[model samples]
Target: MAEQMSRGSQEPIRNRFPTLFEVLSRKTVAPLDLYSFYIYMRDQQRAVDYLDFYLDVSQHLILCRAYVRRLHRSVFEDTPEIEKNSKRSSYILHDAGEGPSGEKGSIADQRLSAFLRSDHGSRAQSPQNSHGSGRSSPAGRERPPRPSFMTLDSPGDSSSPGHASSSENVPRREDLRGSAEKILYTYLLPGSEREIIIPQSILHDVQEAIEGPDQRSDPELFDSAKDYVFQAMERDAFPGFLQSKGLGNLVPQSMMFRLIIGLISVFGAVWASFILILRDKPRTTRCWLILPYTVGIYFIFTHQYMLDPILALLGYSEYTLFDFNRMREPFVIKTLRMRSMSMLLFFLLVTVATCCIFIFVPGKDL
Candidate 1:
């Protein structure tokens, strides 16, 4: 549905962007897919390479979602009135598809003027945002299409020369990118999508996040997008699967490393107890002798004081409630530094156990 984005240019978006992908069902376009693309772009922070090429080639386009997926690249890349380094501003999306309804150029000028005045500080505005939810646009206005497999269905899928094939299982990157473009063009570009006006400071933080220390880190590309976009990502946290498939696989003998350590301690106590028994000493003291070691090992495994460091080493993101600006906070830094010691300790413990076995066991040679 279309209505006035401003005075006079109430034309439908399809006429302007004129891309068919704009009308596709949304199911084919997953939020995570879009988030990934956002992650890639936002990481660039300021570099949109080949700007004019995209702008010109995509002139007949609406703002596609973040990714480059399908055949439609039609969107009017109208020069935004936002100037360089406008610290405070909000993005206003206008349906370039809709021809100017008001006095020619007035609507675009109005949108630009608002962005310029705000210095990019205010909320990004879109026509959709102004329209209440579930409300239809006035007659003859264009609305975003729901994306679907049927739309992307190629000639191979349908035996129709102009259509898509039916047998493709997974979509390619181009497909994803095209779909993303359409989403952006229709839903996000103009005053259609929710205007997420992030503070410049926050944007800087996001840039810093992806661009690591020494300024080499990949930027957090997803920061500027819908919050729920990545809810489906199963981040590869530990590479534990690799370990489990190989050296890290925990059989019964090594199931819980803690349990293994306890078993070793118990064996030590049992051996010591046997020695006492052979010398005609009481057997009851054996369990008592082993109790401390069992308790100690149990606590160590449960608390994982050592493992935290290791996990951090394996690239865990860190956050803390404590403010450090006022105090030295050396302890906090120190603790963070030592987060990876668990992996080291596991090896060290193994070494210590080996030494003990060689020293204490009868007829054992190391």
Candidate 2:
């Protein structure tokens, strides 16, 4: 889709910054890219809560899909056959063991089992049953007959009025609906700790889909929500993200070191300038000052913006200082290191040259 859209446009896609969707959909943008963006939003922008909500919802949807698939397989494919065979075996055993005392014993056992089953069913269907308590039912306990409303053909179909009396499977559907509602209230609804800031129309759409009669989870709703989030970030947050100082927030050590080096270079430049100006010197001696002055000026300009144009002239037209800072490729890092070292070396050499001119070349005196 993105390729087709790019093709339809006059501008080459590569010349433009990629949207958040493009960045996320592409496999090449690793987790580190997202992490760096998260850090920037968290620390610099101070608006990371929406992103947090988006991530949580995304994870929840993935888990819900996996769980639904597993549930579908277990309920439709496995349970009925296993129950039929087990019941048939139990009936045969009871018939074989029928005798005077055995028959009486069997009757007593049936009564007790019926009572236990009824009690377990009531507990399982109770609204008051806690989430953890549902799992404590005995393993060997018989499951109630599969509800008529649930079918192999359409697992997501809503419960039919005819099967309303068979309340056994209703709890499972209710549990799914209730879980989804909980997530909605916790993240998307008003007063949530990390409420997502989306358009009211999108929020309404999400609420309607989740709260609808559909018994099964809706993957389309989640996909739409994710798309809206990506679009919102791309439209609103992306420009700020691009303009922000690259990965400085992510790698504070490197940023601090770079700042310190820049300060040293600026100081060296100023010191060299002052030394040349303060003493009245022959033009021959002053001519040597150009070297230190040039080195100092180069460092000052290239520290931020000037290097970009020079690199553009050298065929790296698309590269910016932001890209340089954010990229962790071996060559990029090596280039940055080399630039820093060169700055330091130039500073040292200029200092030594200034000292030489100060000592060796005598200043004019009356």
Candidate 3:
């Protein structure tokens, strides 16, 4: 029974992210395997950097499943139905009648009616229109008199610029509440039963693994970074936030790693250049020349896609890097496959160049 339950749980994970499952199944895979899993999640041979968009959708679905499970457990827990339905006196649903006693046609109601009739009669008795003093009001030209203490403007009225501007700036409580509801439904509530069966931990593990050892060691670091990102995004646009963070010395972990790699590569390139200039042999010189260019190209081409793993480290949603809607287009998938292939090729070239520069080139010079 335990084995069956484990298999049942694993099945949903396999179906949702087969690449990630396969990568996890491998014992010797690198941390980048997680990033690759997300990239190739939809494709066998290609993974665009933008494929990270599915990560967000997957997270949303996972959150939705959890919400469903929590709601189910909360609803079906041991509790009396009558007690659940009971309300405080303040929360009681009152009748729409005039008062608590259900009384109507009272003196107050009569007085209110009389006041409305008198006000209507006063409005209807206006003689001079707005044009001039002697100009008698035309039929239906009698305008409603403005109240002394207050004014009410129709929502659709365009005549009052100030009123329209002020109303536009006033946030609608219904809109704000409705937006909150829509976000909850879209990201944290399952529309169907299938989503509720899938586990979130597996996906989170994959994302964490790809992020790096730093993030995996301390998940709270990523949480803090995510909170910072969310706050920055709320205050301004994503691009602007990125710029501000950059100017403020808040460098991304991926960029830091890349910078470290770049500095090392620059040293290697300089060493190789010197070796090439001093070396007399043609074959040895060629090997030394290729090293710097290969390393530089590898870093340049892979930097964008590399940001995914970095963001994963920062606890940012993959949707920040890519959109799920693009996942459906065949052209986009093909382009991503091509890019992935190019990056792989560049990586292979860099590896070969490094090996040659260190091993073969030294041997030839000796």
lDDT of 3 by residue, 96-149 (tens): 111246454333233322332332332322213322235644544322211111
lDDT of each: 0.30, 0.44, 0.34
**Candidate 3 wrongly placed segments (more than 4 Å):** 1-251, 288-293, 304-366
Q: In model 2, which regions exceed 4 Å deviation? A: 1-19, 29-32, 79-179, 208-217, 222-224, 239-268, 281-366
Where is the poorest 10-residue window by lDDT in model 2?
144-153
Q: Write the per-residue lDDT of candidate 2 for residues 80-143, one digit (tens) a residue.
A: 6657556543443233223235455335333333332332332233333322223433332222
Error of 3 at 269 (Å): 2.0
Residue 312 displacement in candidate 3 (angstroms): 12
* Window of ten residues with lowest summed lDDT in model 3: 89-98
Highest TM-score scorer: 2
* CA RMSD per model (angstroms): 21.0, 17.5, 23.8
Candidate with more favorable, higher lDDT: 1 or 3 = 3
Answer with 2 or 3, whichever has the higher TM-score.
2
Total residue pair clashes for candidate 3: 0
